[model samples]
Target: MTSTNKESNGSPSPSDSSKGLWRNLQFARMFIAYALATFGDWFDALAIQVMVAYRWGADPLIIALIPVCMAVPGILLGSVAGTLADRFHKVRIMLLCDVITVVLTIAILFAPNAIWLLPLLTLRAMMGVFHIPAQQALTRQVVSEEHLFQASSLNGFVAQCSKVAGPLLGAVILAVFSPQFCIVINACTRLISGLVLWPLRKLVQPKQWEGKGLTGQTRTETESVLTQWVRGWSFIRSRRIILTTMLFGCFGLLAILMIDYQFTTLFRAIKPGNESLLGWLASSVGAGAVVVILLLNRLPQIGYGWGLGGGFSFIGIGIAALGWVTPLTPEIWVIVWGLCIGIGNGLSMVTMNYLLQKETPPAFVGRVFGIQNSLSSIVLVVAPLVGGILIRSAGPSPAFQYIGMATFMIGIVGIVLQRVLWAEKKSPVAALQE
Candidate 1:
């Protein structure tokens, strides 16, 4: 592959230099399935938070447990999930995940009290831990290297867009039906995503699933999961591009998650009973992401260090600004500030991911991303709990300020990583390598 894919970046992969507006049919199908599933997840997210806060009378600490419960399993089990994704048929893994999700969503409907929400959400999150690595690995396998950047960008945009659409859909649902019904709607969407993937069954199988190497040899594959796990971890440790960006991105993820778990609280703090305002604030993020997605080809053609560090710095500024300016101070200020956060999220996340994908091989994609996801979960797991406590003790306004500052600190970390990478560039071997 070339250094840049002109369709998404400024150039193209060596294999397919021609430009195209859409990924091939196979990738397109997967996108549809994924988008449907992501929308469901967003809807469930909004419903759960609203239910926990309004229906359960959950304090910030208790509500914080919801995201914590969902994330902790990723930290604990993501390695296994990533390895399994490589070993198994990714399509089957995705299908099974959806099936399990449907079952779990129904289980939530029958849950006797809000206490059950955490455990159920945790199970669903774990299922996702398996599904996501597989999907990422599978996408790399199926999509052309030339199209990967655009495909990844489009997929990322879809996921973020769902965050906008799902919450808005949830707002409408809550307006008409009980929050419990949102769980049911989510379950149905999961089923839809699975059904959509059914057509790819015969075509989506990779060599790894057939007990062979990616190159189609009856290779002596590592017999032990432990060995595979170690290889994966070792790969993550060795790649400065992956390792540093993963660590730096944590701050942005933390800031975003804090806002995620605390959105209702933030909105209510501004104006209680303004249920739809949360959607409006959340939608602004999608708006910002849309701007970047639309301008995908126009982004500065820079090296990974500059692209990732500068992008993260931008995200940090936006997030910190949002935290510093609480909603109640001025509603328009909060809404407009959300656009900044979203734009940062889009630019930083897309750039970092593209860099990671460019560096990762098909064989290691699952494990590398698995480690990345797990590392991210470390922040995701802790941010909500700490944010809850902060919200309770410091109130949403100050709590938000703290989250924003934490995110801003990540920008500093990114700059340092960029400098270190630039210094390493003098070494021809590593700099010359992918």
Candidate 2:
């Protein structure tokens, strides 16, 4: 691990050996490609929603079901996908998925109606189920353990940039063109990601059978895909800290992701019949994340506990204030609150991801991330429906307030958990795992 020093102001500074994380040529290529892909996805999503709203006049439930449909494949097949990432070359999996995305994204363009697009969207989600674990595992391979947090921050930075760039771009294109144009842009982005990543095939190192023989391995190696998936699950079950963190993080996100399902309605509450404003407001959240990612090196030295707990707290405070804001209030304040939520979201997500990569056995990193996806799938499935119902019954404001309160309370619990479950001293696996 490269040893880090402090800047004059006392913030953790990138080590000379690691200072070039963002400047690393290999990573820069991958990150840019990944960001382009993400930007396309977000833009496509917004374009689809706009299409649905205009073409079909989708109700709240219909709006909510989009994300739910997207989550279904991850719930059912995420573990299997994780196991596959471990079994195969991760870079190949990513390239293959990106290729698949090019084909699948085009299908959305051909959808004659909004109803036809749902299934195509679900197919794209299925590709994501495979792409995510591979992406996480590959990220672990590219950077050093000491620089993991920084690497994760860079990744989040790209993601946040997408969130900012995507919708705003979508809004502009949608104004001039149709949903088909957005879909074409998404398909082209995938092709671009593939072209960018194709040259990096030599960069991703292959897994070594460190202690295993070519032909002496057990029958389990030759077993069915189901058997391999069970192995992935068994690995996660043996890692209690990773498991616990996954559960807690998912539970916390369950409270927060409601925002995604209800965001369209909530944004509309601020200014009805306006779509471009929604893009700008959505960009505000990403703008917050972009700030954090850019200045990530200057953030104070903090333990995983403080990082995670603080993130939760920020998100809670932001959402609560977001709910409390009225139409009479200035819209800038709403953007401010949304930015808070995005910052918290980026911090906790990236920190926990760093912890997971640092602690997990290299062999099982793919599977663990897969199981993490499954847990998130569960939250995504339930939260959207519940959030949509809350918006329908109690209205978006109260829903945001109540749900944000729940997250705020969870943040408090996370703080306590940080003290009790995590160590006063460091341990490699989730801060306390042995």
Candidate 3:
């Protein structure tokens, strides 16, 4: 195995330096399965919102609870999910989660009221908390180290594509059919994803645990779950690169998420009656992401630090530009701003995944990602409310400008700190000898 120091510094792994990502058949299959599952998830997401807000005529607070239901499970159970990913067979966990999700999604059609729908939605989201860590762990296993960035870029591309296509498809279906029909389609997608992944159970065998944790710490089979979970946090703290990357990434995410939910409100102020322009702006973001992913994939290698810092800076600038979107502003420029934000999203996501996978050992990767997810979920829960408050008190334009500038400064700090934070660390033996 390549040393963590080498990989963390963006050096190509010796294992698969020459192998192209497209040539890896296992990754191709996994990509297809992930695309299907992610696309299906968006369908369910849009359908559920429509069901709650329109079909059920739910109040604003009740509608707000929908996202809360989805996010809270990750906040509560992410560590446990990550631990399971480390201990169990990842393929099996993904398969089981898919099956359970399919059942729950189908059951959603029969939900008589908001009370029943909320719990079912929460359970389905809980399945995702387990599924994500397992899928991420599985990605580390299937892809060689050198191609991790390309693989992560491709995954982000699929997600962005789904974010655009899924809702458009759901909207079209809802126009002709019903949200329940869309839910049924989601169930089918999960079922097919399970079927596609089922073959991997035989082809990709699980490695036996060596009962070793990070940095030569013991992680015996007899250890308690809490102990292992605590160890995961310890491992992160001990690795400065991983800890810094995760913290800075989450900080950028906080800034972005704070403004994410306010875009529509901003649009409303800029143009009162044009609803379709919002959709076009969203599609522009997806288009921007797609462009960046394609560009990154063509590169032989990428510097994780540059990707992270540049991406956040681009995002901050894009958000700040929105402040200029007055009634006199051209709609095309607004879309261009959205595209800029998308570009930043693409850069950050690919590098973030690559950094985490490269720095974390397979044994701890699940826990690492699990904790990352939990932290993100916390931001997801809080950031939107803060964004709302800021918009209401400061107004959208001023709030956007201030928040955007703060975020831009964060990116600058990340760039300045990257050299110190990501410098290759001395090995234990070398340190002891010195």
Clashing pairs in 1: 5-11, 6-11, 6-12
When 1 and 2 are scored with TM-score, the better candidate is: 2
Candidate 2, residue 135: CA error in Å? 1.2
- Which run of 10 residues does model 3 get worst, by summed lDDT? 3-12
Worst 10 residues of 1 by lDDT: 3-12
TM-score of each prediction: 0.81, 0.84, 0.92
Q: lDDT score, residue 37, model 1?
A: 94
Task: Order candidates by lDDT, high to low.
Answer: 3, 2, 1
Clashing pairs in 3: none
Provide the lDDT at 167 for model 3. 94
Candidate 1 runs further than 4 Å off = 1-23, 50-62, 115-117, 204-219, 255-279, 297-303, 323-330, 387-406, 412-419, 422-434
- Among these predictions, the greatest lDDT belongs to 3
lDDT of each: 0.71, 0.74, 0.83
Q: Which residue runs of candidate 2 sit more than 4 Å off their true CA positions?
A: 1-19, 22-24, 55-64, 202-224, 263-280, 297-302, 391-396, 424-434
Better of 1 and 3 by TM-score: 3
